[model samples]
Target: MEGILNAVVLFSNFVLIPGMAYGSQLALGALGVTLIYSILRFANFAHGDLMAFGTMFVILITWWLQSIGVGIDPLPTALLALPFGMAAAIAISLLSDRFVYRFYRRNKSPAVIFVIVSIGVMFLMNGLVRVIIGPNDQEFGDGARFLIKVREFKEATGLNEGLALKLSQGLTIAVTFVVVIALFWFLQKSRTGKAMRAYSDNEDLALLSGVNPDKVVIVAWVIAGSLATIAGTLYGLDKSFKPFTYFQLLLPIFAAAIVGGIGHPVGAVVGGYVVAFSEVTVTYAYKKFLIYLVPESWEPESLVQLLSTEYKFAVSFVILVVVLLVRPTGIFKGKVL
Candidate 1:
């Protein structure tokens, strides 16, 4: 009885908490991609790089701030530097929109061509980040490494299960909530946001109705940039910041967006959490937790993880394919067709 109880506790601590935090991060990242796809009318292969660039910006600012002996007291100073990073990302997004995407758009290129252009832009951005940040990992987010210690929780709870949640994870969820609420309010309630939606629904009608298409596109990019920065910084703060890791993250982000239903903001949020949980749960060895749930005679010799650690990405891809097959529209009724 005690052993089974212990396993359950351990699983809750190790699997659920980490998964929730990661899902929040991926959801935020996917939201940015979905927004761009809706407004820009292309699958932005460069988005992953945009996230990388934003994190790189934060890394740079964090280094500068640390050099100046400036740091947040109880929280990571990178959180403080996030606004600047967000602005920088917005600028970059706008510039990319102007220089690369805008030209093709004006040329009346097919979306297939725009998709090709986006891939080129992705490579360019990847190279740019590599050149600037040198294809290296930069650890800049600092302060309050953990909000709770597992050992401490064990002492307090006196249970088999104990959780050690990070402050960055808490901040990521809180910030994501705030950002999501603000974003939805803007899209569902605000004028400019409604205008953008209108433009998305019918570009010609929006133009005829005196809605400035350029303004809407610019606004969408700005929002996308902000989301990219926020997601990147929070993720860096939670784990570590690596420029290349962001590129690698694109697969899961797409999975989340696609699984949650593309172009639906709420879906993006849900999709993020779903992907996060899937990644963690699939990779998490459940032996510790399951030992408590099953009798000794039933206890398997192996760790009960559904997939190996290295197969996390594979798990995400599988879930995405399954979701698409089961419900093409997505969990939140996002547009699949």
Candidate 2:
């Protein structure tokens, strides 16, 4: 029984908790991607860089605040700087839409053209972020490091295994809950949200029915920008902020979005947890976990990991390929990609 308890605790510490935090981050990112695809009718390849850009601003603001001796004890100082970072991100998103996307939208360019343009934008944003913050990892997290300490847990439970929960993980889950609720409310009840939905469903019909295309597009960008910033900031708090890391995150983010159903918001959230857990579970070395459950004679001699941690991203790629091949519309029947 004690071994079983220890096994559960160990699994929770290494896999469950981290998976949830990572899922929340991925969900937010996937939401942004789905929003743009639903409304704008194109996948924004630059979404990852958008996240990096917003996080870069948040990091700068956090540093400035720390230098001035301002902070919210027990809470990340990044929270205080979030609004400013969001605003900056939103501004850039709008500017990009106006200068780059709007022209193509006006000309009624094909989705392929928009996709190519987004790739260009991706490179541009990536370059800009690297120039501003450098390609090196940036450590900006500051606050209470843990909500539950391993030593404390062991002492309290008198168990061989301990569970530790980080403050950033808790914050990520909490903030994601709030954001998702607010988004659902807005989409379900607000006039603007309805218009956006109508446009997404049928642009020609929506325009004929007096839905302003420009307004819908603007709102989509605003929401996407906000989500990107929040997700990036939360992820940075949980891990370190590296510009290239976010770029690499593009694979998992897109996988989550597609797996959940590209145009479906609910699907994005669900897909996030699915991808996160899959990656964490598959990469985790399960030798100790099995040892806790099996007889001494059956104890494994080698790590029971399906794949190394370094190949975790490949899990997302495989899932993405499988989903695309089996059901292009995804689990929620969002849109045929």
Best by TM-score: 2
What does candidate 2 score on TM? 0.99
Error of 2 at 181 (Å): 0.9
> Residue 281 lDDT in model 2?
99
* Candidate 2: tens digits of C-alpha lDDT, residues 21-67: 99999999999999999999999999999999999999999999999
The digit string of per-residue lDDT tens for model 1 on 264-302 reads 788888988888887888788877676677767887788
Native-to-model Cα distance after best TM-score fit, residue 74 in candidate 2, in Å: 0.9
The clash tally of candidate 2 reads 0
